[model samples]
Target: MASVTLTLLPGPDLLFVITQSVSQGKRDGIAVSLGLCSGLIVHTFAAAVGISALLYHSAVAFQLLKYAGAAYLLYLAWMSLKETGRSGLSATEPKRSFFSLYKRGILMNVLNPKVSIFFLAFLPQFISPAVGKIPLQMITLGGLFFVQALLIFSLVSVFSGMAGEKLLKKSMGSKSISYVKAAVYALLGVRLALLEK
Candidate 1:
């Protein structure tokens, strides 16, 4: 329940997925979601292995990662803004490969140091020394979290895609979509830039 709630909460991941669905298509959104969840695998392992602890304790490492994430998001925002200058038709836009979207999602999620710290803090509450093995238990919990997150993100993609298609048919131009996407990315970038350890 907690995992589902967390997944459903408004965050960079959810915003990115929604924007992709609204602007591109459902499949692209799902590809991004998959990539984001793949990043969770890394975070889960890092938490279980105490690497997250190291990051948390190292201010320079944390700051470097945070800034990198912020910069990347800003770059994405700039790219979206640049798209606004193109022909105002969606049909003229070049299709992005699934791999590109997936890679973007992975980079977006992986660059956020807070996620690893979150996993480091959140995963241990359910753990027990009485368990067969601590790391195994953490992995199990992480897997559950990953599955739930993927389902929720995919659902968001589908619904958003449907709405976006309708909106496009109703005369929402590609330029408008580009503006919205740019706004989302910019806001996410600013939020990430202001994030603290």
Candidate 2:
């Protein structure tokens, strides 16, 4: 229940997926979600091996990662803003490759140091010393969290994608959509940049 609630919260990952769905389509949204979840595998392993603890304790490392994430988000915002002049999804508009979006999602998730720290703090609460092989227990719990997150993200993608298609059919201008995307990315970047360890 906690995992479900957390997944449903309006965090960066959720907002990113929604923006992709609204602007691009459902397929792209799902690709991004998959990449984001795949990045979680790294966090899961880090938490199991106690590497996340190092990130939590090292302020420099945390700051470096946080800044990198913020910079990347700002870059994305700039790119979206640049596209604002293009006409609405005309036949000439080149579709973004799924792999690119997927890679973007992976980088976005992996660069956020807070996620590893979150896993470090959240996973151990459910662990028991009597269970033995603590790493295995953490991995199991991480898998459950990953599955639930993927399901929720995918559902959001589908619904948002449908709405986006309808909006496009209603003759919404591409510039307007680009402006919205740019604003979202910019806001998220600023929020990340201001994050503290």
Candidate 3:
């Protein structure tokens, strides 16, 4: 059999995750980020285990996933364009239950497609299949990313949400926050669009 190669992936891109959490209200921000991070942990394991692994090896599967991710990113872009502080900063709180939040996190990461493929491409860089410990390495790397992601997203949530809440109370501050968020989301969406599998 021809030799197969493996390596460590670059891990998760925390920028977008941090940006997303920063827009939410403070008290609930960290909770939501942690919620998302929790989902990421599972995704890392899933990728390390099988589903994402196979998908990465299959060109057809990877393409399919890439398109799907691009579409989702576009949808997010549209949402960001339509959403301004006027509506997002309203007095009402999110009606989503904890279960819903958890589910949302799972679905968000799982459906992104880019994330899974990224793991497939990235994780192998640090792996040494020839050393007879690929799985162990994958798990360790995934865990590292989980911790980093959790830390970054948590800080984003706490600071952004809390500061945003204070700013949201002021019309100028609310507008400023919304503008930044809108730009970030739109920019990320555009970047995702340009990504190749």
lDDT values for all models: 0.90, 0.88, 0.60
Instruction: Kindly report which residue stretches of model 2 are placed more than 4 angstroms away from their true locations once superposed.
Output: 87-89
Writing each residue's lDDT as its tens digit, candidate 3 over 41-123 gives: 66677677888878766777767656665565556556655556454556563444656655545554565567776676777
How big is the positional error of residue 185 in model 1, measured in Å on the Cα after superposition? 0.7
Q: What TM-score does prediction 3 earn?
A: 0.69
- For candidate 1, the clash count comes to 0
C-alpha lDDT of residue 10 in model 1? 92
RMSD of 3: 6.2
* Model 2: per-residue Cα lDDT at residue 84: 77
Best by the lDDT measure = 1
lDDT of model 1, residue 68? 98
lDDT score of residue 197 within candidate 1: 82
lDDT of 3 at 113: 63
Residue 160 local lDDT, model 2: 85
* Model with the higher TM-score, candidate 1 or 3: 1
For model 3, what is the alpha-carbon lDDT of residue 67?
A: 62
